[model samples]
Target: MSSTFETVAGIMSETADIPRETITPESHAIEDLGIDSLAFLDIAFAVDKAFGIKLPLEQWTQDVNEGKVPAEEYFVVKNLVSRIDALVAAKGA
Candidate 1:
């Protein structure tokens, strides 16, 4: 996998208290893992701290509510990885 993927999975595992071994890039944050809103926020905060990049979680929530993006698609682990990677790269981190 990628370093970003590893870091993301590690953060998710630690923050969400889920087993790292069971987490995959494709894992569904809600359907497969039952990540509640609290857990999702916790994960998002951890991710922001880890990557030193502010995640637009509130915007995503707004988009979801506005029917721009489905919540399920946004909550995928790979999506997090991709977003983090992009943000980090853009920052030249």
Candidate 2:
């Protein structure tokens, strides 16, 4: 797995109490990992803290409302990693 994915997995594993080995790029956090809305928020917060970049929570809602990402892909590990990678880059600039 990529380092970003590894970081994300670690965060999710701790935040959601999931086994790290089960987290995959393709894992559907809500459906597969039993992550409910509150857990998702916790995971998001953890992600924000781990990377030292505030995730654009409002923008995520906007993206969902604007159809930027299909509902299914929104919380996928790889997709979330991509979003974090973008923010991580921006923070360094």
lDDT of 1: 0.85
lDDT of 1 at 76: 86
- Candidate 2 lDDT over 1-93, as tens digits, reads 789999889988998899999999999887888888788888888888889989776677677789986756567778888888989999999
Of candidate 1, the 10-residue stretch with the lowest lDDT total is 71-80
Q: What value does the lDDT take at residue 48 in candidate 2?
A: 83
RMSD of 1: 1.6
The candidate scoring highest on lDDT is: 1
11-63 per-residue lDDT for model 1 (tens digits): 87888889998899899888888788899899889888888898888898999
Superposed on all Cα atoms, the candidates' RMSDs to the truth, in angstroms, are 1.6, 1.7
Question: Each candidate's TM vs. the true structure?
Answer: 0.89, 0.84
